[model samples]
Target: MIFSALSPLLRSSALQNLTQQALLRMDAETAHGATISALKLGLAPQQTHTDPPELRIALCGLDLANPVGMAAGFDKNAEVPRPLAQMGFGMVEIGTVTPRPQAGNPRPRSFRIVEAGGVINRMGFNNEGHDAAYARLKGLRVPAALGVNIGANKDSEDFVADYVLGVKRFADLADYLTVNVSSPNTPGLRNLQADEALRRLLNEVLAARAKARVRVPVFLKIAPDLDETALDAIARVVLATDLDGLIVSNTTITRDTVAGMENANQTGGLSGKPLFNLSTQKLAQTRLRVGDLPIIGVGGIHSPQSAVAKFEAGANAIQLYSALVFGGLDLLDRIKRGLAAAVRAQGKTNVSELSGTQVADWAAGKAEL
Candidate 1:
C-alpha cells in the first residue's frame, strides 16, 4: 500500500495537457481537491530522483534538490507531501495549519481568472489542525526538503499562543517553519505583519522553539502590499531577530495589476502572473534591508524566465503555487530544466550566485518588468 514507487516527472506531454484541461473544467475548489486526492492516491506521474548539481542549494540548514518548492497553500494538510515531492519539487511546504481546525470560508471561496492567468482565493486557512497534520507527518518519507507553514486559528483567543503551539508542535517535525502572518483571508491576520506585533510573535515562536529538543529554522511569510515605510519596519524587525529566512510574499489583496481580468474584483487575495513585479520588487527591497538573511520569493512564477527573475530580484530560493495551478507538475520540471540552463549560461556553478545581482534597481523601484 506504500505509494513510494511512483515517479513525478515521467509523463507524456499529451497526457499532462489533457489532465490540465480536465482540471480546469471543474470549479477551483473542486479542481484543487481532485488534484490533492490524485496525489494522495499516487495517481500522478513520477520523475527520476536525480537533481542537477547546479540547482542544488542550501536553505535553512537543509539541502534542496532544486530551489523550486511546492508552496504552502498547495497541501493544507500533510496528506500527500511525499507524492508532491515525488512530483519533482525540491521542497514541499504543507499547511496554513492552525492550532484548531476550521472550515475556512464558505463554498466558492476560490476563483480562477483564466483570462489573466490569475487566481483569487479567500479560503481562510481551513485545515485539519496541527495534531492531525503532525500525526500524518510523524512517520512520512519524502525525498525533498520539508517545511510547515503555521498560522493562528481564525477564532483563537490569543494569536501568539497559537503560533507558539505550532512552534512547539512542529519544531522537531519540520525541516523549517514558516510563520504565515500575511494571509489576507483571515481577518486581522495581516495586522501581525506590523512591526511590534511581528516582533512579539517571533519572540514567542522562537522562545517556544528554544524549548524544543530539536530547533527548527523559522521563516516569515509576509504580505507584498505593504508601503515602503511598513516594509522598512518589517525588514528591521526581521533583521533584528534570529529568524531563519523570509518568504517575500504570500498573496496580494490589491487588484490594480490585473484590473480588467475576470473575477478581478473578487473579495480575496490575488496571485499568479500579475503579482510578479510588485512581489519581486518587494523581495529585492527586503534584501536591501536585510543583507544576508536568505529569502524565498513566491508569487506569479510560471516560467523559466520568471524563476531566473526571482533570483535576480534577491531571492535565495523560490516557491510556486498559483503557477502550478495553471501549469501542472510539468511546470516544476520545466522550471528546473530552464533554471539550470539559465544559470549555466551565466557561467555560474552555484545557483546562489544569481541572488541579489539587481537588487539596487529593484529596491529603487526602477526595475522594468
Candidate 2:
C-alpha cells in the first residue's frame, strides 16, 4: 500500500532507498514479483541523466548508448523490459523462455546470501512459453537494445530443435538472441556445451537464423565453471561458426568463494560478488581464444569497479542482475558514472577502448579475487 501511495515520489533517492530496504526484508521471490509489478505499473524509478558519450558502444551492429545491460532472468517473461530500459540500462534482455511453459523447480527455489552479496537459484527457467513472451515483445519498442534469451523445454524431445524454434520465433522481434545452454537448473542442459554437441547446436540454430525474415545476431551463453580444456573446445567450436558473439558466462555451480557461508551448499548456480573473479578470468580466457569476436560479460558485477573489470578482462559489453538484489536501482547509475570516470582516467575516448586492456593479467590469474 505504501508503494502504491508513494508511487509518484519513487524518484526521490531517500524514498527509493527505503523501498529497497523494505523489499529486501520480504521473501526473495515475493520481492521479485512485487518489483516486477511496480515496473509494469510504471512506478519504477526513472533515469534522469543522459549517458556520457565515452560510454557509447556498438555491439553486434546495435548502436547501444552504453555497454551496460540488464541480464536475462530478471525480466524472465518479458513483462517489464520497457520500464527497465527507461531505468537506464543500455540493453535489457528477457527470458530463458522455453518452447513450452513449465512451473520450474519447486517453491523456495531462490535463496539469498546477503552476507556474501550473492544469490543461489535453481529456478529452472520458469517462464511463460514462446507464445506468451513473443506476444508481449512483438510490437514493443524501447530505447535500450532488446535481447531475448532462449532455452529448450525441460521435456523437449530434441533440444537443438527447440533452440532452432526459438531463433525462428523471435528473429523479427528481438535485436539479438542468446542461445542459453549454460543454466545449471535444467538437467542435461550444460551438456549442450560440450564441443560436439555445441557444434551441432550452433549449426542448427544458425541454419534456422539464415531463414529468418530479419537475421538477428546470436550469442552463446556459457558457464563459468570451465577448465582450460573445455574452454578451449568451446572457443574452437564457437570460432568455427558464424555466431555473432558470446556471453562469457552464466552462473556457476561452484561455491569455492562462498564455501562457509549460509546457503553456500545450495543445489543451484551461485552469482554475485563471489562470481567476479572466476567469471572474469573465464571471460579473459575466452577472449584470448576467440580473438576479435565480441563478448558480453555477466556474473557478479556488483559495482563500477567490477563493471570495469569485466571490460578490462575483454567484454565488449557487460550485464548484471544478482547485484541489484543488494544495491537496488541506484547501483545501475553508480556503475554507469563510475565507468565514465574510469574511462576518463584511463585516457580513453570510448568505453570500448578498455576491453582486453588487462586480459593478460586476468587470464594469468594475477588479478586479486
Candidate 3:
C-alpha cells in the first residue's frame, strides 16, 4: 500500500534506479538462467488464497491463462519461452524473426529513455532466422500460450514471399502467428501497411497459412502513427480478408508525447509511457471500425490502471515491453493485481466482460489528458 501510494512519484526517478539495478542483476545468459531458476521454483506458490484468479484471455480460439502477455522483441530468438511462461504471462510472443538470419541494426540501437519511461530501438528485426527460431520453439517446454512474430528480412526484395515462407515453416510450431508489417525501423516496411499493399500482403499470407494446413490464428500488427483514414482502410482490409486479430500497434516514430526526454530524438520507434495514450486511442478507433475483431493492445502500459485503460479501449489482451524495462518485474504483478481489483470493484466476474465497455469513457478521458 505504501508503494501504491508512492508509485506516481516513484515512477519519476526512483523507479528508474530500481529498474537499472534489476537489469544489472541479469544479462542475457543470466536472465535466461534466472528465468529457468524461477520456473523451477514454480508459480510463486499462490501466496494469497483470497485473491481472485487472474483474467483469462481468449484470442483466436486459443485461451490464455491471464490477460497479460510478453510482447514480441523481448525474447527475439525464442530462447526463453519456458521461463517466460513460468513468469505467468497469459502468453508470450517470440521473434520478429526474418526468413533469413539478421544481425539487426548496429549497437547503441536500443536506448532506454528512463525519464520518459520509454525505449527507442531501431533493432531492425534481428533474430536467428525462422528455421532456428522454429527449432527453439519446438524445443521449449512453455506452459503458456506461445505466439510467433514473423517478419521479412531487411534486405529482402520480395516481402510477401518472406511472410509466406515463414508461415509454411513456422505456423505449426506456434499457437498463433503475427504478421508484423508495422515496424518503422526497417526500410520499406511500413509501406506494406498502405491500403492496396496491405490487401495484397494479407491475402498472400492468409493463403499461405491455408496451404500449410495449419489452422492457427494469424494476427496483424499495425503502427500507432496512422491517421483515421489509414486505420479505417487497414481495418477494412483485415475484415475483408478475415484475419484472426490485430495487435493495435507496434511503436511510434512521432516524438510529440515524449518531446523533453533525453533520447527522445533518437531515430527509432518510441514505446512506453509516452505511447500509452496514442496507442490506446488507436485501439479504440480500431475497435470501433473493426467491430468484433479481437485486439492485442501494446504500447505504453506501465501500471494496472493503464492495463485497465487498454481493456476499456477494446484490447482482448495487453502486452508491454518498455514498462518491463522501466518498471521491472513487479510491474506485472501490480498490474495483474490492480486489474483484478478493478474488475471486482466494478462487479465483473471475468476480464473479458470489461473489454470495450469503457471506450466512450476512455476516449473522453484521453481528450482531457
Winner of 1 and 3 under TM-score: 1
Lowest summed lDDT window (length 10), candidate 2? 1-10
Give me the overall lDDT of model 2: 0.88
The Cα error of candidate 2 at residue 357, in Å, is 0.6
Per-model RMSD to reference: 3.7, 3.1, 5.6
Sort order, lDDT high to low: 2, 1, 3
Position 164, candidate 2: lDDT? 94
Candidate 3 lDDT by residue in tens digits, 175-231: 889999999989999999999999999999999898766687999999998998998
Clashing pairs in 3: none
Please identify model 2 stretches exceeding 4 Å from their true place.
1-18
Selected candidate, larger lDDT, 1 vs 3: 1
Q: Against the true structure, whose TM-score is highest?
A: 2
Clashing pairs in 1: 7-46, 7-47, 8-46, 8-47, 9-46, 9-47, 10-46
Judging by lDDT against the true structure, name the best candidate.
Answer: 2
Model 3 ranges with Cα > 4 A deviation: 1-19, 22-51, 361-369
